[model samples]
Target: MKETFVILARHGATEWNRISRYQGHLDAPLSEEGLEQSRALAGALAALPIKAVYTSPLSRARICAEMVAAQHGLAVTSLPGLIEICHGEWEGMLLSEVEVRYADLIRQWRTYPYTVRMPKGESLVEVEERSWAALEFMAAAHPGEISLAVTHDTPIRTILRRILNLDQAVFWQIKLDNTGINVLGCRQGRWRVIALNDTCHLGGWLKAGEQMAL
Candidate 1:
């Protein structure tokens, strides 16, 4: 089989993101800064031979996907499987709030993410299964070509965990910045991570002397 490359990118900043809130499956719109980031992302990826664009159905991801697709003159494809992990009851809560209320579960989620299921939500295992399937489908549909997927942080992290053969225990260790780009290459029926959490494109948009904490 021919090698196929897929670029997985996290959506830009949202209001929830700035407040450190868990967005989960909630459909939050991108903030003003997020729009700028999305525009910058489109410009950065404009030079690539991107043939297709796939994104989570959620507006945040869709918005970014549209911008990128516009640059390549391609239509955006929304995939439900690429949506962010459902936080269940914790969806709209601030991270600090979840830390205080569901301290134990949060610890386990931070430690053994693969083992714990969100209350009324989903397990990391479930997330990996669905998102990977979506990604695989994308890769299979576009052999010897490049495609881009705009999704959330958790899905990107989980997908990377699988590609890099990393233990699920360190899931949270992988930090994904808003508009971060990750590259995956598939050859011989196997996928390898070519790049991870690359945010170099955001350099011009970032404030001078300000650092990204993602």
Candidate 2:
């Protein structure tokens, strides 16, 4: 059977990302550095035989999706199911601030994320369900072809966790950098991960130490 290749990528960085703030459903634009990273990500995938491009409706993911789609002369199709997990009241707050304000929840989030839900937001189980359904739909729609989907950190991690059949507690262990690329192959609804968080495209930018915890 022919496999459908899906390139799952995390959107480029934002000021909130650099500051360790929760972005959730906020529509933050990419920083200058983020724009450069998106460009590099696009350049790296330019020669691939990509048939379509998809992205979260959020602007951050849209920026990267548009760049990569432009390279292939394709229009980006926004998928709400691929959006980031809503951090609800914690959307724009810093991690440190959240830690102080919601001490118990914050501690639970790091230690037992699967059991903790962000104040008014979502749970890991919720993200996994929607994101995995979205991925399944994408794979079914593009059989035997290659496609790309740009999304946020939580969606990537949750989807990868589900794909790899890993325990929910291991959620925080996945390290997906800004503009990180992941590849998966699917056939008849069976998925296999080919790569995870490949950031070699960013070159020297990886040394900038811009990555921070969510």
List TM-scores for all candidates, in order: 0.93, 0.96
Candidate 2: misplaced stretches above 4 Å?
Answer: 204-213
Q: After superposition, how far is residue 4 of candidate 2 from its true place, in Å?
A: 1.0
Candidate 2 residue 174 C-alpha distance from true site, Å: 1.3
Give the number of the best model, judged by TM-score. Answer: 2
- Return the lDDT, model 2, position 182: 95
lDDT at 49, model 1? 95
- Residue 147 of model 2 has an lDDT of 89
Give the clashing residue pairs of candidate 2, or none: none
TM-score of 1: 0.93
lDDT of 1 by residue, 74-188 (tens): 9999898999988898988888888889999988876787888778998888889999999999998899999999998888988998888998788888778889889999997
Please report, as a residue range, the 10-residue window in candidate 1 with the lowest summed lDDT: 205-214
Backbone clashes counted, model 1: 0
Residue 170, model 1, lDDT = 85
lDDT of each: 0.87, 0.88
